[model samples]
Target: MRRGASASHLDAAAAVDAALPAWLGLPNNAEKVLLTLRAARVAATARGVAATALGVAATAPVVAATALATTMAELLQRLFELQEGHKELLQRHEELRQRRM
Candidate 1:
């Protein structure tokens, strides 16, 4: 949270602010959106894993298993995406919050 942003820009800032749930290191305002997404996806995976173990139908077990496998694959893909986004955002945040040093 710096200064001079209008309501709309402030809203955008706030949105990003909401995304970032934690702040470990920064000179200025940073770290939000990506962290929230990460936490959500991890929670989703755990839920999905549990759901997969539950009995659903007799004839549809194969279909269900396939869907569960596909979901797990997509979940993994999204996790990788978050890792890359985190790396990129960390660099950008550092650049934005620079100081004379």
Candidate 2:
């Protein structure tokens, strides 16, 4: 009877140990499950990174076009400002000539 009770106690203790979370300490079965979960998480992260890289690759052309358009707009604005300044300078020169005459 005493030997049977000790065996039963050990079985109960083992059951409790197995039921405990992996973070405390894991038996073989729990360790396997934890490893699988970690692998799955890593795979998910890798897939997300791959998707992001593809998205950036797809948008590269659009981004370059937008940058080009912005540069052209800035250049046009500078040209207009320079033209306006030239017109003002010509008008001032004409006024000075009329005064001299």
How does each model score on TM-score? 0.37, 0.36
**Candidate lDDT values, in order:** 0.61, 0.58
What TM-score should be assigned to candidate 1? Answer: 0.37
How many residue pairs clash in all the candidates, one count each?
A: 4, 0
The per-prediction CA RMSD against the true structure, in angstroms, equals 9.4, 31.7
- Candidate 2, 1-101: lDDT as tens digits: 69999999999888865553544664535544554465456555644554465565432444343443455556556655664565577579879999999
Q: Where does the lowest 10-residue lDDT sum fall in candidate 1?
A: 24-33
Candidate 1 ranges beyond 4 A from true positions: 1-65, 99-101
How well does candidate 2 match the true structure in TM-score terms? Answer: 0.36
Best by TM-score: 1
The regions of model 2 sitting more than 4 angstroms off are: 1-65
